[model samples]
Target: MFGRSKDSTAPADQAPALTEEPLGTVELPGGKGRPTPKRKTAEAANRRPLVPQDRKAAAKEARAAQRAERDRQYAAMQTGDEKYMPAKDKGPVRRYIRQYVDARWSLGELFLPVAIVMLLLNMLLTSVSPELAFLGLVVLYLFIIAMVVDVVIMWRRLRKKLAAKFGDAGQQRGLMMYAVTRVFQIRRARLPKPQVKHGDYPE
Candidate 1:
Protein backbone atom coordinates (compact mmCIF):
# COMPACT_ATOMS: atom_id res chain seq x y z
CA MET A 1 0.00 0.00 0.00
CA PHE A 2 1.17 3.49 -0.75
CA GLY A 3 2.21 5.49 2.42
CA ARG A 4 -0.37 8.14 3.43
CA SER A 5 0.74 11.78 3.50
CA LYS A 6 2.15 12.82 6.98
CA ASP A 7 -0.70 15.38 7.30
CA SER A 8 -3.31 12.66 7.00
CA THR A 9 -3.55 10.31 10.00
CA ALA A 10 -4.18 6.60 9.47
CA PRO A 11 -7.30 7.05 11.60
CA ALA A 12 -8.94 10.56 11.94
CA ASP A 13 -10.60 9.57 15.25
CA GLN A 14 -8.07 11.20 17.68
CA ALA A 15 -9.59 14.11 19.77
CA PRO A 16 -8.14 17.65 19.61
CA ALA A 17 -5.57 18.44 22.38
CA LEU A 18 -7.09 20.38 25.41
CA THR A 19 -5.45 23.69 26.48
CA GLU A 20 -5.40 24.99 30.17
CA GLU A 21 -5.94 28.72 30.71
CA PRO A 22 -3.41 30.61 32.92
CA LEU A 23 -4.64 30.73 36.56
CA GLY A 24 -6.91 33.70 37.33
CA THR A 25 -7.12 34.70 33.65
CA VAL A 26 -10.46 33.05 32.81
CA GLU A 27 -13.50 35.47 33.06
CA LEU A 28 -17.12 34.52 33.71
CA PRO A 29 -19.94 36.42 31.96
CA GLY A 30 -22.38 38.46 34.18
CA GLY A 31 -20.25 37.98 37.36
CA LYS A 32 -20.64 40.81 39.92
CA GLY A 33 -17.98 39.59 42.44
CA ARG A 34 -20.55 39.20 45.31
CA PRO A 35 -21.44 35.96 47.02
CA THR A 36 -24.74 34.46 45.79
CA PRO A 37 -27.67 35.09 48.19
CA LYS A 38 -29.07 32.07 49.99
CA ARG A 39 -32.53 30.83 48.94
CA LYS A 40 -34.08 31.65 52.36
CA THR A 41 -32.72 35.24 52.28
CA ALA A 42 -34.02 35.88 48.78
CA GLU A 43 -37.44 34.48 49.62
CA ALA A 44 -37.68 36.62 52.83
CA ALA A 45 -36.86 39.80 50.89
CA ASN A 46 -39.56 39.03 48.35
CA ARG A 47 -42.20 38.24 51.02
CA ARG A 48 -41.70 41.37 53.20
CA PRO A 49 -44.57 43.92 52.92
CA LEU A 50 -43.72 47.63 53.08
CA VAL A 51 -46.99 48.77 54.62
CA PRO A 52 -49.40 47.14 57.04
CA GLN A 53 -52.32 45.54 55.20
CA ASP A 54 -54.78 46.01 58.12
CA ARG A 55 -55.16 49.79 58.56
CA LYS A 56 -57.72 49.52 61.38
CA ALA A 57 -55.54 47.17 63.37
CA ALA A 58 -52.60 49.52 62.98
CA ALA A 59 -54.65 52.49 64.23
CA LYS A 60 -55.83 50.53 67.26
CA GLU A 61 -52.30 49.55 68.14
CA ALA A 62 -51.17 53.17 67.93
CA ARG A 63 -53.94 54.30 70.31
CA ALA A 64 -53.13 51.52 72.76
CA ALA A 65 -49.50 52.66 72.82
CA GLN A 66 -50.57 56.27 73.51
CA ARG A 67 -52.87 55.20 76.35
CA ALA A 68 -50.16 53.10 77.94
CA GLU A 69 -47.75 56.02 77.78
CA ARG A 70 -50.31 58.34 79.40
CA ASP A 71 -50.94 55.90 82.24
CA ARG A 72 -47.24 55.59 82.86
CA GLN A 73 -46.87 59.37 83.12
CA TYR A 74 -49.80 59.59 85.56
CA ALA A 75 -48.21 57.01 87.82
CA ALA A 76 -44.93 58.86 87.73
CA MET A 77 -46.65 62.12 88.68
CA GLN A 78 -48.29 60.46 91.68
CA THR A 79 -44.91 59.13 92.77
CA GLY A 80 -43.18 62.52 92.33
CA ASP A 81 -40.78 61.30 89.68
CA GLU A 82 -39.05 64.50 88.55
CA LYS A 83 -38.21 63.14 85.09
CA TYR A 84 -41.87 62.60 84.29
CA MET A 85 -43.46 65.59 86.04
CA PRO A 86 -45.47 68.12 84.03
CA ALA A 87 -43.73 71.30 82.88
CA LYS A 88 -45.39 73.32 85.66
CA ASP A 89 -44.10 71.02 88.39
CA LYS A 90 -40.61 70.23 87.09
CA GLY A 91 -37.31 71.73 88.36
CA PRO A 92 -35.54 71.83 91.72
CA VAL A 93 -37.13 75.14 92.71
CA ARG A 94 -40.59 73.67 92.36
CA ARG A 95 -39.59 70.72 94.47
CA TYR A 96 -38.30 73.03 97.16
CA ILE A 97 -41.51 75.03 97.10
CA ARG A 98 -43.56 71.87 97.37
CA GLN A 99 -41.55 70.69 100.35
CA TYR A 100 -41.77 74.03 102.06
CA VAL A 101 -45.50 74.29 101.60
CA ASP A 102 -46.12 70.73 102.69
CA ALA A 103 -44.11 71.13 105.89
CA ARG A 104 -46.40 73.75 107.42
CA TRP A 105 -50.05 74.02 108.35
CA SER A 106 -52.01 76.33 106.07
CA LEU A 107 -55.29 78.06 107.03
CA GLY A 108 -56.32 77.69 103.42
CA GLU A 109 -56.44 73.92 103.87
CA LEU A 110 -59.36 74.33 106.25
CA PHE A 111 -61.21 77.06 104.34
CA LEU A 112 -63.24 74.70 102.23
CA PRO A 113 -64.47 72.52 105.06
CA VAL A 114 -65.17 75.54 107.31
CA ALA A 115 -67.06 77.34 104.57
CA ILE A 116 -69.23 74.29 103.88
CA VAL A 117 -70.08 73.88 107.54
CA MET A 118 -70.89 77.59 107.91
CA LEU A 119 -73.19 77.50 104.89
CA LEU A 120 -75.25 74.63 106.29
CA LEU A 121 -75.51 76.26 109.73
CA ASN A 122 -76.46 79.56 108.18
CA MET A 123 -79.22 77.88 106.20
CA LEU A 124 -80.68 76.38 109.36
CA LEU A 125 -80.30 79.68 111.24
CA THR A 126 -82.14 81.53 108.46
CA SER A 127 -85.24 79.35 109.13
CA VAL A 128 -85.02 80.17 112.88
CA SER A 129 -84.16 83.93 112.81
CA PRO A 130 -83.09 86.41 110.13
CA GLU A 131 -80.82 88.22 112.60
CA LEU A 132 -78.89 84.98 113.41
CA ALA A 133 -78.43 84.28 109.73
CA PHE A 134 -77.06 87.81 109.21
CA LEU A 135 -74.61 87.22 112.06
CA GLY A 136 -73.49 83.98 110.43
CA LEU A 137 -72.77 85.87 107.21
CA VAL A 138 -70.66 88.41 109.12
CA VAL A 139 -68.68 85.58 110.79
CA LEU A 140 -68.08 83.92 107.42
CA TYR A 141 -66.85 87.23 105.95
CA LEU A 142 -64.47 87.73 108.91
CA PHE A 143 -63.11 84.20 108.53
CA ILE A 144 -62.45 84.83 104.85
CA ILE A 145 -60.56 88.01 105.66
CA ALA A 146 -58.45 86.17 108.18
CA MET A 147 -57.68 83.39 105.70
CA VAL A 148 -56.58 85.96 103.10
CA VAL A 149 -54.26 87.64 105.58
CA ASP A 150 -52.72 84.29 106.54
CA VAL A 151 -52.01 83.40 102.93
CA VAL A 152 -50.42 86.79 102.30
CA ILE A 153 -48.22 86.38 105.36
CA MET A 154 -47.27 82.85 104.39
CA TRP A 155 -46.25 83.97 100.89
CA ARG A 156 -44.11 86.82 102.24
CA ARG A 157 -42.20 84.54 104.61
CA LEU A 158 -41.86 81.85 101.95
CA ARG A 159 -40.62 84.40 99.43
CA LYS A 160 -37.80 85.41 101.76
CA LYS A 161 -36.83 81.80 102.35
CA LEU A 162 -36.96 81.05 98.65
CA ALA A 163 -34.78 84.04 97.84
CA ALA A 164 -32.25 82.96 100.44
CA LYS A 165 -32.08 79.44 99.11
CA PHE A 166 -32.51 79.91 95.37
CA GLY A 167 -32.02 83.62 94.65
CA ASP A 168 -34.51 85.61 92.54
CA ALA A 169 -35.29 82.73 90.20
CA GLY A 170 -37.07 80.91 93.03
CA GLN A 171 -39.84 83.50 92.89
CA GLN A 172 -40.47 82.90 89.21
CA ARG A 173 -43.64 83.81 87.37
CA GLY A 174 -46.53 81.35 87.97
CA LEU A 175 -44.58 79.84 90.86
CA MET A 176 -46.51 81.80 93.51
CA MET A 177 -49.82 80.86 91.95
CA TYR A 178 -48.71 77.24 91.78
CA ALA A 179 -47.91 77.26 95.48
CA VAL A 180 -51.16 79.04 96.33
CA THR A 181 -53.28 76.53 94.44
CA ARG A 182 -51.53 73.65 96.14
CA VAL A 183 -52.19 75.28 99.50
CA PHE A 184 -55.95 75.26 98.84
CA GLN A 185 -55.96 71.57 98.08
CA ILE A 186 -56.24 69.22 101.05
CA ARG A 187 -52.86 67.67 101.85
CA ARG A 188 -54.25 64.17 101.45
CA ALA A 189 -55.53 64.99 97.96
CA ARG A 190 -52.44 66.83 96.73
CA LEU A 191 -50.70 65.42 93.65
CA PRO A 192 -47.03 64.44 93.80
CA LYS A 193 -47.91 63.23 97.28
CA PRO A 194 -45.98 65.15 99.90
CA GLN A 195 -42.44 63.88 100.10
CA VAL A 196 -41.78 65.70 103.40
CA LYS A 197 -43.67 65.20 106.63
CA HIS A 198 -45.09 68.16 108.53
CA GLY A 199 -42.22 70.27 109.97
CA ASP A 200 -39.72 68.55 107.67
CA TYR A 201 -39.18 71.61 105.47
CA PRO A 202 -36.43 71.50 102.87
CA GLU A 203 -33.14 73.15 103.65
Candidate 2:
Protein backbone atom coordinates (compact mmCIF):
# COMPACT_ATOMS: atom_id res chain seq x y z
CA MET A 1 0.00 0.00 0.00
CA PHE A 2 3.10 2.29 -0.03
CA GLY A 3 2.70 3.94 -3.62
CA ARG A 4 0.44 1.66 -5.74
CA SER A 5 0.31 -1.89 -6.73
CA LYS A 6 3.28 -3.07 -8.78
CA ASP A 7 1.21 -6.03 -9.98
CA SER A 8 -0.83 -3.78 -12.43
CA THR A 9 -0.64 -4.27 -16.28
CA ALA A 10 1.33 -0.90 -16.81
CA PRO A 11 5.21 -0.75 -16.96
CA ALA A 12 6.98 0.60 -13.94
CA ASP A 13 9.27 3.24 -15.79
CA GLN A 14 7.19 5.99 -17.67
CA ALA A 15 8.34 8.72 -20.31
CA PRO A 16 8.09 12.47 -19.42
CA ALA A 17 5.08 14.51 -20.96
CA LEU A 18 5.93 16.25 -24.44
CA THR A 19 5.17 20.02 -24.08
CA GLU A 20 4.75 22.46 -27.20
CA GLU A 21 6.05 25.94 -26.28
CA PRO A 22 5.42 29.04 -28.63
CA LEU A 23 7.90 28.78 -31.56
CA GLY A 24 11.01 30.28 -29.93
CA THR A 25 10.61 33.90 -31.21
CA VAL A 26 12.68 33.93 -34.50
CA GLU A 27 14.81 37.03 -33.84
CA LEU A 28 16.09 38.71 -37.11
CA PRO A 29 19.51 40.46 -37.37
CA GLY A 30 17.91 43.79 -36.23
CA GLY A 31 15.78 42.54 -33.49
CA LYS A 32 12.15 41.47 -34.38
CA GLY A 33 11.75 44.44 -36.95
CA ARG A 34 11.00 43.56 -40.69
CA PRO A 35 14.04 43.70 -43.05
CA THR A 36 14.04 46.74 -45.49
CA PRO A 37 14.24 45.74 -49.22
CA LYS A 38 17.26 47.14 -51.18
CA ARG A 39 16.46 50.15 -53.43
CA LYS A 40 17.16 50.03 -57.25
CA THR A 41 20.02 52.32 -58.47
CA ALA A 42 20.40 54.45 -61.71
CA GLU A 43 23.44 52.32 -62.69
CA ALA A 44 21.18 49.24 -62.61
CA ALA A 45 18.46 50.95 -64.73
CA ASN A 46 20.67 51.48 -67.90
CA ARG A 47 22.34 48.04 -67.69
CA ARG A 48 24.87 48.99 -70.40
CA PRO A 49 28.57 48.09 -70.29
CA LEU A 50 30.63 50.62 -68.38
CA VAL A 51 32.66 52.88 -70.74
CA PRO A 52 36.33 53.78 -70.10
CA GLN A 53 36.61 56.62 -67.56
CA ASP A 54 39.44 58.41 -69.45
CA ARG A 55 37.71 59.08 -72.80
CA LYS A 56 40.35 61.68 -73.86
CA ALA A 57 43.12 59.11 -73.42
CA ALA A 58 41.25 56.57 -75.56
CA ALA A 59 40.64 59.19 -78.28
CA LYS A 60 44.31 60.20 -78.28
CA GLU A 61 45.35 56.57 -78.70
CA ALA A 62 42.92 56.13 -81.61
CA ARG A 63 44.25 59.28 -83.32
CA ALA A 64 47.81 58.11 -82.84
CA ALA A 65 46.96 54.80 -84.48
CA GLN A 66 45.35 56.60 -87.42
CA ARG A 67 48.41 58.81 -87.87
CA ALA A 68 50.65 55.76 -87.77
CA GLU A 69 48.59 54.10 -90.48
CA ARG A 70 48.79 57.24 -92.62
CA ASP A 71 52.57 57.34 -92.15
CA ARG A 72 52.79 53.70 -93.19
CA GLN A 73 50.88 54.46 -96.40
CA TYR A 74 53.10 57.44 -97.12
CA ALA A 75 56.20 55.31 -96.58
CA ALA A 76 54.85 52.75 -99.00
CA MET A 77 54.49 55.47 -101.64
CA GLN A 78 58.14 56.54 -101.27
CA THR A 79 60.69 55.70 -104.00
CA GLY A 80 63.36 54.40 -101.63
CA ASP A 81 60.88 51.94 -100.08
CA GLU A 82 59.49 50.82 -103.44
CA LYS A 83 60.03 51.41 -107.17
CA TYR A 84 57.73 54.38 -107.57
CA MET A 85 56.50 54.80 -111.14
CA PRO A 86 54.56 57.97 -111.97
CA ALA A 87 51.11 57.44 -113.40
CA LYS A 88 51.51 59.99 -116.19
CA ASP A 89 54.24 62.07 -117.86
CA LYS A 90 54.45 65.81 -117.38
CA GLY A 91 54.57 67.15 -121.00
CA PRO A 92 54.41 70.84 -120.18
CA VAL A 93 56.96 72.06 -122.75
CA ARG A 94 55.15 70.36 -125.63
CA ARG A 95 51.85 71.68 -124.37
CA TYR A 96 53.21 75.21 -124.14
CA ILE A 97 54.52 75.13 -127.74
CA ARG A 98 51.24 73.68 -128.98
CA GLN A 99 49.23 76.33 -127.17
CA TYR A 100 51.53 79.06 -128.55
CA VAL A 101 50.98 77.78 -132.10
CA ASP A 102 47.23 77.64 -131.59
CA ALA A 103 47.27 81.20 -130.30
CA ARG A 104 49.29 82.34 -133.36
CA TRP A 105 46.75 80.81 -135.76
CA SER A 106 43.88 82.40 -133.88
CA LEU A 107 45.56 85.79 -134.12
CA GLY A 108 46.23 85.32 -137.84
CA GLU A 109 42.55 84.66 -138.39
CA LEU A 110 41.60 87.83 -136.49
CA PHE A 111 43.98 90.06 -138.50
CA LEU A 112 43.67 88.48 -141.98
CA PRO A 113 40.59 90.56 -142.88
CA VAL A 114 42.24 93.78 -141.73
CA ALA A 115 45.29 92.99 -143.86
CA ILE A 116 43.06 92.43 -146.88
CA VAL A 117 41.26 95.74 -146.28
CA MET A 118 44.56 97.59 -145.91
CA LEU A 119 45.92 96.08 -149.11
CA LEU A 120 42.78 97.24 -150.94
CA LEU A 121 43.23 100.74 -149.48
CA ASN A 122 46.87 100.75 -150.59
CA MET A 123 45.81 99.83 -154.16
CA LEU A 124 43.37 102.80 -154.12
CA LEU A 125 45.98 105.16 -152.69
CA THR A 126 48.55 104.09 -155.30
CA SER A 127 46.47 105.92 -157.93
CA VAL A 128 47.46 109.24 -156.18
CA SER A 129 51.13 108.57 -155.17
CA PRO A 130 53.43 105.52 -155.34
CA GLU A 131 55.27 106.78 -152.19
CA LEU A 132 51.92 107.05 -150.34
CA ALA A 133 51.10 103.49 -151.38
CA PHE A 134 54.48 102.22 -150.18
CA LEU A 135 54.11 104.02 -146.83
CA GLY A 136 50.57 102.69 -146.41
CA LEU A 137 51.73 99.13 -147.11
CA VAL A 138 54.51 99.41 -144.48
CA VAL A 139 52.10 100.89 -141.92
CA LEU A 140 49.57 98.11 -142.72
CA TYR A 141 52.19 95.39 -142.14
CA LEU A 142 53.17 96.93 -138.75
CA PHE A 143 49.52 97.22 -137.77
CA ILE A 144 48.94 93.58 -138.67
CA ILE A 145 51.95 92.48 -136.59
CA ALA A 146 50.74 94.59 -133.64
CA MET A 147 47.30 93.07 -133.99
CA VAL A 148 48.81 89.58 -134.01
CA VAL A 149 50.80 90.26 -130.86
CA ASP A 150 47.75 91.71 -129.10
CA VAL A 151 45.60 88.69 -130.07
CA VAL A 152 48.32 86.30 -128.85
CA ILE A 153 48.51 88.06 -125.47
CA MET A 154 44.73 88.05 -125.19
CA TRP A 155 44.61 84.34 -125.97
CA ARG A 156 47.26 83.60 -123.34
CA ARG A 157 45.25 85.54 -120.78
CA LEU A 158 42.06 83.73 -121.79
CA ARG A 159 43.79 80.36 -121.61
CA LYS A 160 45.05 81.12 -118.10
CA LYS A 161 41.56 82.23 -117.06
CA LEU A 162 39.99 79.12 -118.51
CA ALA A 163 42.61 76.90 -116.94
CA ALA A 164 41.92 78.51 -113.56
CA LYS A 165 38.17 78.33 -114.11
CA PHE A 166 38.04 74.67 -115.18
CA GLY A 167 41.40 72.93 -114.91
CA ASP A 168 44.73 72.60 -116.71
CA ALA A 169 43.55 70.01 -119.22
CA GLY A 170 44.95 70.11 -122.75
CA GLN A 171 41.78 68.62 -124.25
CA GLN A 172 39.65 71.29 -122.60
CA ARG A 173 41.93 74.08 -123.87
CA GLY A 174 41.77 72.66 -127.43
CA LEU A 175 37.98 72.43 -127.32
CA MET A 176 37.62 75.99 -126.04
CA MET A 177 39.97 77.35 -128.73
CA TYR A 178 38.15 75.42 -131.47
CA ALA A 179 34.77 76.68 -130.31
CA VAL A 180 36.05 80.26 -130.11
CA THR A 181 37.54 80.07 -133.65
CA ARG A 182 34.26 78.73 -135.09
CA VAL A 183 32.35 81.53 -133.43
CA PHE A 184 34.82 84.11 -134.80
CA GLN A 185 34.51 82.67 -138.31
CA ILE A 186 30.73 82.85 -138.21
CA ARG A 187 30.84 86.48 -137.00
CA ARG A 188 33.33 87.40 -139.76
CA ALA A 189 31.11 85.84 -142.42
CA ARG A 190 28.05 87.77 -141.19
CA LEU A 191 29.91 91.10 -140.98
CA PRO A 192 30.43 91.50 -144.81
CA LYS A 193 26.73 90.94 -145.74
CA PRO A 194 24.70 94.16 -145.50
CA GLN A 195 21.17 93.92 -144.09
CA VAL A 196 18.44 94.79 -146.66
CA LYS A 197 15.78 97.00 -145.08
CA HIS A 198 12.09 96.53 -145.83
CA GLY A 199 11.00 98.17 -149.22
CA ASP A 200 14.50 99.43 -150.10
CA TYR A 201 14.82 100.06 -153.81
CA PRO A 202 17.78 98.24 -155.43
CA GLU A 203 20.34 100.82 -156.75
Candidate 3:
Protein backbone atom coordinates (compact mmCIF):
# COMPACT_ATOMS: atom_id res chain seq x y z
CA MET A 1 0.00 0.00 0.00
CA PHE A 2 2.99 2.37 0.64
CA GLY A 3 4.31 2.18 -2.95
CA ARG A 4 5.66 -1.32 -2.22
CA SER A 5 5.39 -3.99 -4.96
CA LYS A 6 4.77 -7.68 -4.49
CA ASP A 7 8.58 -8.15 -4.39
CA SER A 8 8.96 -5.28 -1.97
CA THR A 9 9.63 -2.91 -4.97
CA ALA A 10 13.43 -2.80 -4.41
CA PRO A 11 14.72 -3.82 -0.96
CA ALA A 12 13.67 -3.50 2.67
CA ASP A 13 16.00 -0.46 3.10
CA GLN A 14 16.59 0.88 -0.40
CA ALA A 15 19.56 3.17 -0.93
CA PRO A 16 18.55 6.66 -2.07
CA ALA A 17 18.97 7.32 -5.81
CA LEU A 18 22.53 8.60 -6.40
CA THR A 19 22.10 11.26 -9.06
CA GLU A 20 25.58 11.85 -10.60
CA GLU A 21 25.61 15.60 -11.11
CA PRO A 22 29.06 16.93 -12.05
CA LEU A 23 30.48 19.20 -9.30
CA GLY A 24 30.68 22.04 -11.81
CA THR A 25 33.75 22.29 -14.04
CA VAL A 26 37.21 22.44 -12.48
CA GLU A 27 38.91 25.41 -14.17
CA LEU A 28 42.63 25.51 -14.63
CA PRO A 29 44.45 27.71 -12.08
CA GLY A 30 45.50 30.30 -14.69
CA GLY A 31 42.98 29.47 -17.40
CA LYS A 32 42.00 33.15 -17.67
CA GLY A 33 38.50 32.06 -18.75
CA ARG A 34 39.94 29.75 -21.39
CA PRO A 35 38.61 26.22 -21.62
CA THR A 36 40.94 23.43 -20.46
CA PRO A 37 42.35 21.09 -23.03
CA LYS A 38 40.75 17.69 -23.37
CA ARG A 39 42.70 14.66 -22.08
CA LYS A 40 43.92 13.79 -25.58
CA THR A 41 44.89 17.39 -26.36
CA ALA A 42 46.73 17.74 -23.07
CA GLU A 43 48.60 14.45 -23.63
CA ALA A 44 49.64 15.49 -27.14
CA ALA A 45 50.69 18.91 -25.91
CA ASN A 46 52.79 17.38 -23.14
CA ARG A 47 54.75 15.44 -25.77
CA ARG A 48 57.48 17.19 -27.85
CA PRO A 49 59.25 20.22 -26.47
CA LEU A 50 57.36 23.50 -26.28
CA VAL A 51 60.62 25.44 -26.14
CA PRO A 52 63.58 23.53 -27.53
CA GLN A 53 66.71 23.75 -25.36
CA ASP A 54 69.11 21.29 -27.01
CA ARG A 55 68.69 22.48 -30.56
CA LYS A 56 71.84 20.81 -31.85
CA ALA A 57 70.82 17.47 -30.40
CA ALA A 58 67.30 17.96 -31.70
CA ALA A 59 68.65 18.65 -35.20
CA LYS A 60 70.88 15.62 -35.05
CA GLU A 61 68.00 13.44 -33.93
CA ALA A 62 65.82 14.84 -36.71
CA ARG A 63 68.47 14.12 -39.31
CA ALA A 64 68.89 10.61 -38.00
CA ALA A 65 65.16 10.04 -38.17
CA GLN A 66 65.09 11.43 -41.71
CA ARG A 67 67.91 9.17 -42.77
CA ALA A 68 66.16 6.16 -41.29
CA GLU A 69 62.93 7.10 -43.05
CA ARG A 70 64.79 7.59 -46.33
CA ASP A 71 66.38 4.19 -45.99
CA ARG A 72 62.99 2.59 -45.40
CA GLN A 73 61.48 4.37 -48.37
CA TYR A 74 64.44 3.40 -50.51
CA ALA A 75 63.96 -0.24 -49.61
CA ALA A 76 60.28 -0.08 -50.47
CA MET A 77 60.96 1.70 -53.77
CA GLN A 78 63.56 -0.86 -54.81
CA THR A 79 61.01 -3.70 -54.62
CA GLY A 80 58.18 -1.66 -56.16
CA ASP A 81 56.19 -1.95 -52.95
CA GLU A 82 53.39 0.53 -53.63
CA LYS A 83 52.42 1.12 -49.98
CA TYR A 84 55.53 3.13 -49.19
CA MET A 85 55.93 4.57 -52.67
CA PRO A 86 56.81 8.26 -52.85
CA ALA A 87 54.04 10.75 -53.66
CA LYS A 88 55.16 10.94 -57.28
CA ASP A 89 54.99 7.17 -57.72
CA LYS A 90 51.86 6.45 -55.66
CA GLY A 91 49.06 5.84 -58.14
CA PRO A 92 47.96 3.07 -60.48
CA VAL A 93 48.01 5.42 -63.47
CA ARG A 94 51.56 6.51 -62.71
CA ARG A 95 52.67 2.92 -62.34
CA TYR A 96 51.14 2.00 -65.67
CA ILE A 97 52.75 5.01 -67.28
CA ARG A 98 56.11 4.04 -65.85
CA GLN A 99 55.73 0.53 -67.18
CA TYR A 100 54.77 1.85 -70.59
CA VAL A 101 57.84 4.06 -70.67
CA ASP A 102 60.10 1.40 -69.29
CA ALA A 103 59.13 -1.20 -71.87
CA ARG A 104 60.47 1.06 -74.63
CA TRP A 105 64.02 2.40 -74.83
CA SER A 106 64.58 6.16 -74.97
CA LEU A 107 67.50 7.79 -76.84
CA GLY A 108 67.70 10.58 -74.26
CA GLU A 109 69.21 8.24 -71.71
CA LEU A 110 72.51 8.36 -73.65
CA PHE A 111 72.41 12.12 -74.21
CA LEU A 112 74.22 13.08 -71.01
CA PRO A 113 77.37 11.02 -71.62
CA VAL A 114 77.37 11.56 -75.39
CA ALA A 115 77.04 15.35 -74.97
CA ILE A 116 79.91 15.42 -72.48
CA VAL A 117 82.22 13.45 -74.81
CA MET A 118 81.28 15.48 -77.89
CA LEU A 119 81.91 18.79 -76.05
CA LEU A 120 85.26 17.51 -74.78
CA LEU A 121 86.28 16.38 -78.27
CA ASN A 122 85.36 19.79 -79.69
CA MET A 123 87.33 21.55 -76.93
CA LEU A 124 90.45 19.48 -77.64
CA LEU A 125 90.14 19.98 -81.43
CA THR A 126 89.17 23.67 -81.38
CA SER A 127 92.74 24.92 -81.78
CA VAL A 128 94.18 21.97 -83.76
CA SER A 129 91.23 21.69 -86.17
CA PRO A 130 88.59 24.39 -86.19
CA GLU A 131 86.64 22.72 -89.06
CA LEU A 132 86.62 19.39 -87.20
CA ALA A 133 85.49 21.10 -84.02
CA PHE A 134 82.66 22.82 -85.86
CA LEU A 135 81.61 19.55 -87.43
CA GLY A 136 81.61 17.81 -84.04
CA LEU A 137 79.55 20.61 -82.49
CA VAL A 138 77.02 20.46 -85.29
CA VAL A 139 76.65 16.67 -84.95
CA LEU A 140 76.35 16.96 -81.15
CA TYR A 141 73.71 19.67 -81.36
CA LEU A 142 71.76 17.71 -84.00
CA PHE A 143 71.74 14.58 -81.82
CA ILE A 144 70.53 16.63 -78.84
CA ILE A 145 67.77 18.09 -80.95
CA ALA A 146 66.79 14.61 -82.11
CA MET A 147 66.63 13.40 -78.54
CA VAL A 148 64.44 16.35 -77.56
CA VAL A 149 62.08 15.68 -80.47
CA ASP A 150 61.96 12.01 -79.57
CA VAL A 151 61.09 12.82 -75.94
CA VAL A 152 58.37 15.21 -77.05
CA ILE A 153 56.79 12.60 -79.33
CA MET A 154 57.04 9.98 -76.59
CA TRP A 155 55.34 12.16 -73.99
CA ARG A 156 52.56 13.11 -76.39
CA ARG A 157 51.83 9.46 -77.14
CA LEU A 158 52.10 8.56 -73.45
CA ARG A 159 49.64 11.24 -72.43
CA LYS A 160 47.13 10.06 -75.00
CA LYS A 161 47.47 6.47 -73.82
CA LEU A 162 47.20 7.54 -70.16
CA ALA A 163 44.10 9.56 -70.84
CA ALA A 164 42.47 6.75 -72.79
CA LYS A 165 43.22 4.24 -70.06
CA PHE A 166 42.48 6.31 -66.95
CA GLY A 167 40.28 9.16 -68.13
CA ASP A 168 40.72 12.84 -67.17
CA ALA A 169 41.87 12.17 -63.62
CA GLY A 170 44.88 10.27 -64.95
CA GLN A 171 46.59 13.51 -65.93
CA GLN A 172 47.84 14.26 -62.42
CA ARG A 173 49.84 17.37 -61.62
CA GLY A 174 53.53 17.16 -62.56
CA LEU A 175 52.86 13.71 -64.08
CA MET A 176 53.76 14.89 -67.55
CA MET A 177 57.07 16.26 -66.33
CA TYR A 178 57.63 13.10 -64.36
CA ALA A 179 57.27 10.97 -67.48
CA VAL A 180 59.40 13.40 -69.45
CA THR A 181 62.17 13.37 -66.87
CA ARG A 182 62.08 9.61 -66.60
CA VAL A 183 62.98 9.48 -70.29
CA PHE A 184 66.49 10.72 -69.45
CA GLN A 185 67.15 8.51 -66.45
CA ILE A 186 69.10 5.35 -67.26
CA ARG A 187 66.78 2.34 -67.50
CA ARG A 188 68.44 0.25 -64.82
CA ALA A 189 68.92 3.17 -62.41
CA ARG A 190 65.39 4.55 -62.52
CA LEU A 191 63.89 4.63 -59.04
CA PRO A 192 61.00 2.27 -58.42
CA LYS A 193 62.83 0.16 -60.92
CA PRO A 194 61.02 -1.01 -64.03
CA GLN A 195 58.59 -3.82 -63.47
CA VAL A 196 58.58 -4.49 -67.21
CA LYS A 197 61.49 -5.44 -69.44
CA HIS A 198 62.33 -3.93 -72.83
CA GLY A 199 60.29 -5.22 -75.82
CA ASP A 200 57.43 -6.18 -73.51
CA TYR A 201 54.00 -4.64 -74.05
CA PRO A 202 52.84 -2.40 -71.18
CA GLU A 203 49.41 -4.04 -71.27
Q: Which one is best on TM-score? A: 3
lDDT values for all models:
0.85, 0.52, 0.84
Could you tell me every candidate's TM-score relative to the true structure?
A: 0.69, 0.33, 0.73
Where does candidate 1 stray beyond 4 Å? 1-59
* Residue lDDT tens for model 1, 34-84: 566789999988896778999899999999998988787778778989887
C-alpha positional error of residue 31 in candidate 3 after TM-score superposition, expressed in Å: 29
Model 3, residue 81: what's the lDDT? 93
Q: Cα RMSD (Å) per model?
A: 10.3, 25.9, 8.4
1-203: candidate 3 lDDT, tens digit per residue:
55656665667567577777443454557655555568999998779877689989989999999998898789888999988878878888888878888887888888888988999999999999999999999999899899999998988988888888889877778888888888898887899888888878575
| Prediction 1 global C-alpha lDDT | 0.85
Angstrom error at residue 118, model 2: 1.7
| Native-to-model Cα distance after best TM-score fit, residue 45 in candidate 1, in Å | 16
Q: Cα RMSD for candidate 3?
A: 8.4
Sort by lDDT, top down from the best = 1, 3, 2
Where model 2 places Cα greater than 4 Å from the true spot, the runs are 1-113, 170-203
